[model samples]
Structures are given as C-alpha cells and as structure tokens.
Target: MLMGEFWGLGVRFRVSAMENCWDFLQWLGPDASTCVFASLDDPSDLVRASAVSRSWRRFVIANGFSRSLCRRICPEVSNFTRAVEVSSSAMNQEVGSSTAVEWESLVREHRIYSYLCRCLVSPEGSSDCIDRCIGASSTDNFPDESIENTLEPSDRVYMRPSYWSSGGEADPQVPESLIYRLGSDLCVVNEIKIQPFKAFFQHGDPIYSVKFVRFRMGNSKLPLRSENYVTDENEGQAAADDNFVWTYISPEFPMLQESVLQSFKLPRPVLCIGGVVKIELLGRVQKQAMDGLYYICVSHVQVLGRPLSPKLALDTSEASGASVLKYFPVDSSSVAPNGASRDDEAREPSRWHAFAATLRHLRAGGAWNQAILNTLLRPVQFAEEDDDSDEEEPYA
Candidate 1:
C-alpha cells in the first residue's frame, strides 16, 4: 500500500504520542536538519533529540552531532531501544494538522529532555549518575584538534580551576587573602569563614544574607550575604534550595549594586574537587565614572553543589567600557599541535589545549597546580608560543 493508504487504514500514531511528536516538530518546523543545526548552540539538549528514535538518532549522527550533545543526550533518553514509529498518515508532503502538531511536540520534548539532562548531569550538579554514563572516556587521553572541536566550550570551561574555599571554622584551609586584579589596582579581597547555625550567623539554612556597602576606591568593604539563604531544611532536596546556606559578597549598597572590584561569596570552598572555576568576562560597563580597565574585574561568582545548591549563583554586573569585546572566533590558527604532531605546521594554541594541559598537570602532582595557575594567569607568556604561534601564518 502507498504511504497515504497506510494511514487511511487507521494505522495512525497514538493520540497521545501524536501530540507529543508534533510539539517537538513545531520547535523545529519542516526542515528538521536546520533545526538540528540550531540545536548546536546547546550541545546537551541536542543529544536528547538524538535519543527519541532511530530516525532522529540517525539524523544526529549523520549531521555530525557534537560531543557534548552526545554526552548530554544519550543517557537521558527514556528508552534507547525503542524505535520511533513514524506516522504513515503524515508521510505525504501535506501533513494533517494533528500530525503536524504531533511532530512538533516530539521535537520539543526532545529538546526539553536534553536541557534537563544537562542540568542534572553536569559535574557542578549531579556528578555520580553522569560519571557512570560516560565512564573511562572521562579520563581518556585528550582528543586531537579535530576531536577537541567536537566538544563544546561549555563542557571544556569546567576543566580548569578558578576559585577554592571552604568553612566550618573561623578560618578555612583556603587562603585568607584572595588576590584578584581589577584595573590598575591589585585588590586583595579578604576572606572570613562564617558557618551556618553559628549565633552571629544563625538565620536560615543555606544561610543567605545580603550586605550593602559603599564602593569607595581605597575602602576594603566586605558586603553581607542576603537575608535569604540555604539551611539544613533544603539539604536532601532534588533542586537548589535558596533557603539552604549560601553566601554573597557585594561592595554596593543595595546588595545588588555594581562596583569596580566586586567578588562573590560561596557557601563552601571547593579544593578536593580538583577542577578549575571558569568565569564569563564581559568587557562592557555601564557606569561612565569607572576607568577603562574596570571591566576586567570579577562581576559575580556561584558555587555549584548537589542536592541543595550545587552550582554557584551569580549576580548580574555591568562590565566596564562603552563597547563590548567581540568573541574571537575559533579558526585553524587556534588549532594547536599534538604531542606527536609538534613538527606539523605552526598552529595557534587552542583554549582547549590549555585546558587539557591543566588537566594533565592535575593528574601529575601538586607542582602541576602552580604551573597551571601561572599559565592561566598569563596564557600569552607560555613558552609554547613558538611552537603554535599563528602570527606569521597568512591564514591567521
């Protein structure tokens, strides 16, 4: 029988199933291939789309699915074994209204599922379940440039160490003075450990408090955390409990005020986790009074923890400068040579290579930490400059 005839025989997608499928297609519309391309912006959600059925999965693979999408989607799919049953009635170029709805629903469901999976599976959230899904590959050798490009920047950003701190006592194991540069001043941000349930600090679980302070240049002000915080009441919850103990440090009055040298306060400092904390640096600022370089300062920070508050909550801050800096596009020049391929044409160093090098050092020993730290502080000064310098290259 012709494809249309099959549907006329009452062999239609289940009503509920049809609805779900159409919802997905609405998000993608007629050309699923381009919709899939749009999904590349979010690797994790794209993966969820791949798990719906054989047709969808095949489409993802054929389109060169991103590694992060592969990682984020495969595990979250409800049943990898189930074959997606296409509706014969909808096979004709002209799809029925009901069938169209079903197709859109199917794609929507896939995207949502993929996003939820990433939120729960990321290391900053639930690490255990995700670890089992992608085993030894977690620690496998760093892939070459081509493979590295397959991984998304969102996945690679977590591979580096940004900040560390912890507290259950007067002073935590982490340093008392955190040195972060802002403009011309090398601001020495002070760290004071405050525990939940303590008399002066007692208010809420996941202790949340807010302090407002003036943004004086010479003044060393430590802002108060918000009045709302996390507490023991939120410990075992599946999602973040704002009531659970969390902290915030601000240098502005309303607690949400923007300042020149701002920093975030975390519920606990993470040291044993052994990964870098990455920050999104926006080079634009709103206040005209601030200096040109003021945008380089830390805008906000969050601490990602599981159960209660697994990820750091960041406050929005306007960066300094009138014009925002454009992101440097990844090009052939950014591809660095591998250990065995060092003799190849000089390639520009990739951010991924720097990230991989840091992971490598972490696997080695303590000295590696210092090495990675120095590299992060001054990536431009690395000796590997000669080996991967893309400056003279015509393509660069």
Candidate 2:
C-alpha cells in the first residue's frame, strides 16, 4: 500500500514501497521506516540507530521520533506550545543557503531531543529540588516565624523557632499555601515530603498539622527573583492563587497529625515546566488555646525530583505562560542551527565530525551523560583562527 505524501516547508517527501530491495529504508519506504523508529521506547536505541547510515539518520530526525518518544514518556511536555531556536536568523544569514539551513535545523532538533530524553529517564537525585522559598499565603508573626524559616531542614536554627504559622482563622475550613521555586527551570517531580511543627515551648507540646494537603505546579505570571522572601503583605494578598498559571494539581491527601516527616508520592512523575511548586494546606487540625481560632504550621518542606538544567533551560519571557526550550550545547561553533563557522568549507564537516565521534562512542557500547553528550558533540578545537574572522560561515 502506498502511504500519503509528506509536506514540509521546502522539501516534499513521498512514501512508496518497493517489491525487492536489500536496503531496509528502500524496501519499507519512509512511512513504514518511521513507524519502526517510533516503536523504539529507549532513547539510546534511537541514537545508535541514527549511526547505522546516513539515510537512516535523515529519516529518524526528519520524522522527529525523539520528540515523540519524549512526549510518550511524560504527557506534560505538550504544554510547550512550540520550540524556538535560540539564534536562527544569525545562523541563517551566515549559512546564506536555504537548502542547507533547512536540513541543519532537523539535525539540531535531533541532538536536543536526544539529550533531553536521556536526562528525563535519569533517576531522581538525592539533593532536594527546592531552590528558594517564594512566599506563604499566611504568616502569624512578622518575621520570626516567617515562611523563610521552613527552608532549614531542622525545626529550629540555634535558639529560634524555625516554622511558618498561618494566621489563626475562626473557620476550620480555611486553606493555606506555601510557594517555592525549584532548583531548575524544569524538573520531574516524583514525591513531596512535609514535616509538621511541634510546639515544644508551649505547654502540652501540641502538634499543629493540616487535615489534608494538595500541590500545584506551574509558572508565575510575574518574574520571580532568586532571593528568598518573607513578604509582610496581608495574609491572603501575597501568595494569591491568581498570580500563577498552574499546569498540574495533585489530589488532596490526608496529612498525618504526628510531628514526623511525611511523604506523599504522586500517582506518577509530573513534569514541572516552569519549576514552581505550591503546597496547599487544607482543614486546620490544631486550635490555639489562647484564642478559639485554628491554624496550620509546617517546620520543613521538600520536593524530590530530577532537575534538567546546566545543559537545558526554560525561557518563560513570553506573556502566554508557555516556555521556549533553549539549547546550550558545549560546542557552540559546531552545533549552530545552520552549521556556523568562519571557514565556509569547514562548516558542514564540523557538524558531521561531531556526530561521527558520538557514533564511535555508541558503537563501543558507551553510556553517555550530559557531559559525554556535549563532549562527543563538540568538534575539535582549532588553535588558529581564519584570516577573515569577521566574515560569515556557511555550509558550501
């Protein structure tokens, strides 16, 4: 059966089968070959397959199998409305060739998605993913028992009470929340751990905990600085729910009334694109003796996940809350979208040499991390520069 034709911006691809052919792609045609490649669940398999031959590499990338596989593993990637090449126009002008620029962009996408796939499959690291505390919905005291106190793992720092308390509310159904910026702009959250406060100084040493807890993850509409804050704004106005565009909201789980570290794992790993997590404490469990109001108090909080950064970063400058995934590959000169270089003749070869090195390692059954990924993607460094350093580079 003949598969329908593929319509690309500048290139048209036709899919038709042949009666007899020794080559795999020739006999199966583009459509069948694409399905076979898409069946591969492992990112490493796709990388090794790309090394089989030039035709195979072109088919794999042109079809965008890596990106599809990534989305299959985590559905949340769909929120990235679209991808923007960091510097496309500069590279396009430097290439000065539409044909080469179109193909080169495909290769760049392959490299990016390949690296991202490997990163996503990695196990959650031991370090906590919380980078800084944004704010709390309510704070009973001005600064002493502020939201900042929850950053410390321990309930007390020296002689201070290290816990955040919500302003006592007469209604027990009132909900409180804590907002925090994760360590990276992108993360895969598997679970969250929270510790309730134990009022040791007070008589009877009562524990203040919430009856239920829920989590929200997304990007802030306003830009957030890295500095940890303890805003003195009124309880409800500071960390208002309207300030963020949440992408994931976990089901409400019952919070233990004990003063121990409690863990609540999600149904599945959630992809936090904007890297902001809000913890909502619902139904206060403890009532203050001095007053008839109830409140929730938390001593420490932690979000456990894998941070995809130091190689990749999220650009949230857009007003729509959607992000642009930016690439920061090590070999900037060689990995340009259109194979940029001062020496026009060497431009195309430089990109291929980087891929060849990667193939060599893959052939040896080597497992690559981000460091190895960048190393293999880097072309050999030239000690000397071309005489026309200011001139543009293009694939000839």
Candidate 3:
C-alpha cells in the first residue's frame, strides 16, 4: 500500500505513458468517463487504472473516485467531512508555480482514499488495538484482579492472577461492561476474541464464563484527560456510557464455560472511529463457591483489526466518534502545500471538477448498488453462515 503514495502523485505512471490507452476522457467526454471508471469494482483496480494515462489520473482525482469507492465499501467513511493531506514547503513552491492549485488537493485525496480503501476491505494482518483498560463495571479484588489483567494474553503467568474478576452479584441478569482505549484514532475491526478464565488454583477449577456477551465501538465526547483516566487502582470509577457515541453495536453472542479462547467474528468488518471499545458481559453463568454469588471472569480479550497509523490520523477536534480522516503524503516536488493548495487560492472550479463531483454522486447512487448486488450474488470471505447449535457445551 506504500506504493499508493507514489501512484497518487502519478509517479509510477510517468514511465508507462502511452499515446493511446482508450483515452476515455477525450473520446467519450466526462459523463461516459464517469459511468466507466465509477463502474470499477475493486479498489486496487481503481488505483491502478489511474496510472493508465495523465488524463485518466486527473479524471480519477478530479472526480474523487477514490472517496466514492471507499464510501461504497464502508458506509462509515461517508461520515468524514473531508480528507486532507499535508505537503512539505518544497512542494508548496512547486504548487505556487502552478495556476490550478485545487487539482493538487484532489491528488492528495486520491492517494489518501486509495490507502483507506485498502485498509478497510483488504487488510493484511491482525493486531490488538487495546492501548489500556479504561475501567470495569465491578471488581472483586481491585488491583489484584482488575480489568487491566485482561490485556495480558495468557490465563496464567508468574504466580499472578492473569484475569479480571467481577464483584459478586445477586442477580445473574446484571450486566457488566469493560471499557478500553485503542491506541489509534481509527481501526477497522473484523472480530473480537475473549477467553474465559479457569481458576486452576481453586478446587474443581471453576470457569467463570458469561452466558452471553456483546460489544460496542465508539468514541468519547471529550479528550481522555490523564487526571480522569480509569484504572485498576480506581475502584468503582468506570467510564460512563453517556460519554461515548456508539457507531456499531454487535448482537449478543453466547459464551462457553471453557478455558479456550472463543472468536466472535462480526457479520461485516466495521470501521471503528474514535477507537473506543466497550465489551459487555451479560448473563453470568458462574458462582464463587465461598460466597455462592454469580461472577463473571475473563482471562483475555482481543479486538483483532488493522490500525492505520504513522501517516494516517484522525482529527478529534470535532465531536467524538465523528473523526475526519487526515493523510500526510510524503511530498515530492510535484505535491502542493497548504496555502498554495487551498481551493480558495484558485479561481472558480473548472467545469471538469464540478461535473466530475456531480457524476460521482450520481454514479454512487446506482453503480454502487449494482456492485453490491453483484457482490451479494457471489461468496464473500468475510461472511460465513454457521450457527453455534452443533457445538457441545464444555463440562463445568
């Protein structure tokens, strides 16, 4: 995907220049070009097609095809107000020499969105995004067995309790939720894995597993100030739900009373903006022998997804959960810097830009729906049709 940065600036396309590559913009005009390019189904194809020719690349940028493609794959991307890519001063001087600076901004958008589309749909690998435990609904032994322990991947380690324990509750229906902060501002989540803890030290090795569990992903309304950070040391100081704006809520999943880690793959990959995850543990199925009260315990939890970082960042300055995508493209001599690239610096947008944006909007309505229909007609790797009915319950 790093090569995408160069493709956005037409770097890779320079050597492959040809006189006649269908030259759609010249032969058929903008409307026909819209229907043809917007019809491209794959994000990778959309990016590579830009390298066909200079007109083709300009048409892709001016139309915001990359953005349209992304929004089609992941609807949450539509929430972004706009995308910005910062360029260096040397690039600014280059843009200063050009009369049409708006075109440069569009090129930046082309690169940024191509990268985003790749991250959202065709992620390469998995990583847990949990930065730290924000808080837990309850804790039986505070620091000894707290939500922080869930961050540890192992169920047992170095004579320490490597799990989180909930305070005993009289009613099994009482739900408990754990809050966590993902290190990045945005993460594309595919699945969440949870491991129930087996108290090997205790007699009979009881496993404290919840009967059902659910998940919520969102962002906090305000920046997490250090003074208000929640931790195992802060007893009963969990972050409240009122502080977040949840964008995705998963269906409740039944849990097994076993020590093995269980995976709950989402129906579809979700774009987690603002990077906050709330794991809701519902329906306690285990009881502490001494107190004879219901308790929920978890050994490990993982939100498996790709977190775009280093260059890509979110602008949290706006309301929480509504983060705008920001891309920092490594500026070449051709890139444009802020003041020089600002659209206001240019005269009224050329008809090509205006018509292209309009065409993208129209094509998005129909062509995207057609693409979705075609996608549904075939098998998708992300979606599976399996039910838990065939699995046997673990012996408690």
lDDT of 3 at 183: 61
Best by lDDT: 3
lDDT tens digits, residue span 1-396, model 3: 343453454433344434444444565678976887787657877767675666767788889888998887777787788887655532563455365666666766777888788778764888777765678888888666767677667776544457889889989999999898776667898899999999988889999998888999878787665334444235434378888878788998998889989999988888887778999999989888898999999989989988765346667575444467776443222334332221111111122222332333343345556555444333212221222232111110
Count of clashing residue pairs in every prediction: 65, 0, 0
Measured with C-alpha atoms, the lDDT of residue 111 in candidate 2 is 71
In terms of TM-score, the best-performing candidate is 2
> Which consecutive 10 residues in model 2 have the weakest lDDT in total?
2-11
The list of candidate 3 runs beyond 4 A from truth reads 1-33, 89-99, 121-123, 201-203, 236-238, 319-322, 331-396
Please report, as a residue range, the 10-residue window in candidate 3 with the lowest summed lDDT.
340-349
> C-alpha displacement of 26 in model 3, angstroms?
6.3
TM-scores for all predictions: 0.20, 0.71, 0.70
Ordered list by TM-score, greatest first: 2, 3, 1
Model 3: C-alpha RMSD to truth? 20.1
Where model 2 places Cα greater than 4 Å from the true spot, the runs are 1-21, 29-33, 84-99, 226-228, 231-238, 319-321, 331-396
Clashing pairs in 2: none
